[model samples]
Target chain A: MAENQKLCPMFEFAFELLGKRWTGLIIRVLLDGPKRFKEISAMIPGMSDKMLTERFKELEAAGILTRNIYPETPVRIEYELTDKGRALKPAMDKVQDWAETWLTPPDQNNGE
Target chain B: MAENQKLCPMFEFAFELLGKRWTGLIIRVLLDGPKRFKEISAMIPGMSDKMLTERFKELEAAGILTRNIYPETPVRIEYELTDKGRALKPAMDKVQDWAETWLTPPDQNNGE
Candidate 1:
């Protein structure tokens, strides 16, 4: 398994990373634009500060999001999706459409 | 958070379910067509039988796939994606495109 993993490009790794607990929501928030730590946490309703910080680091490592630190009074830090990360937009849009079209209200799912 | 979650459609649940370990592979396997238990298991290189069974049941519950029992010489069970499951094709295609174009071989990621 380990040997074969290298032969492949590791899409599963990307899928699994994004698939992690609150990571999808985190990506969605970033898709709109770059956001500070607190702003990201606010967009996602129940996510914790610890989880948010952890996810940011993890995504940064994965090359999905970039963390930029600004030189200022208090030093502003923001996270933004990279080109690879932005590539996920179409897929995410499809999911949102699926959710709005089929997963909303359960009853509305069969409306089509 | 709970109350707010109810107000919004649960896209996260669907994303999380598909995002689960081996679940994305499972969905991808089913994308071609219905398959028997072993067939689905074969496509995913290292997933455990226990985990595959669990994902199938979970996806079935989520209305992503339907289970059918065929009464022939012996008894056979096959799983196929529902309309909702089929609806995921566009998104999955985007992911696969991203994988092949941007995620493949790492070096070829910047192929564009």
Candidate 2:
């Protein structure tokens, strides 16, 4: 395809990847550094293991993240952002800034 | 709340809005100018009326897009980006840029 083709499908695909329930949170957690599966799981409190695995695979396939396995005694596995994934920071930041401006607090908005 | 309260929830919320199946396409369609509902719908060929309605209401509630009603003979309704919605351009651009980089052409990739 040409370089400057219309980006509707691309935007749709990215939205699809980012739109998964815990996908954004997973990327946010990974922003700090490479993380073990357990570490990432711990950071996102309510996500189930099944969902995490699914999102990880989707992200990996999309080339947004990379997974590495070390030849340690116990076999350590870690996930980190690829350059593509890191490039998402600015976009994610814009969303974060908008959310801060518009959304009510969880407690107050939800009356928790 | 503070300007930056970690932002995970906000990111999640924005992702939720952007992630809806037709939501990103809707935003992309709207990029040109304010569009009437039918105009928007025409741009996205496959979407059903009910889904478009749901996404439009959701985007409005999220403070991203605005709806205007004119009391003409036919009662025209139009949708346009709010300042908040306009702010999303950069983020959306990044996703589009990434999609162009990663995704194969629909015809080739899907073997259509």
DockQ of each candidate relative to the true complex? 0.34, 0.42
- Give DockQ: model 2: 0.42
lDDT of 2 by residue, A9-33 (tens): 5666777778677787888788889
Q: State how far residue B42 of model 1 sits from its true place (Å).
A: 4.6
Candidate 1 lDDT over B1-112, as tens digits, reads: 3533453336566566666667666776788899999887777768789998898889888889999999977899999999999898786666666665566664444456
Worst 10 residues of 2 chain A by lDDT: A1-10
Where does model 1 exceed 4 Å of error?
Answer: A1-9, A106-112, B1-9, B41-48, B105-112
- Each model's backbone clash number: 0, 0
User: Candidate 1 at residue A5, lDDT?
Assistant: 42
On TM-score, the candidate that comes out on top is: 2
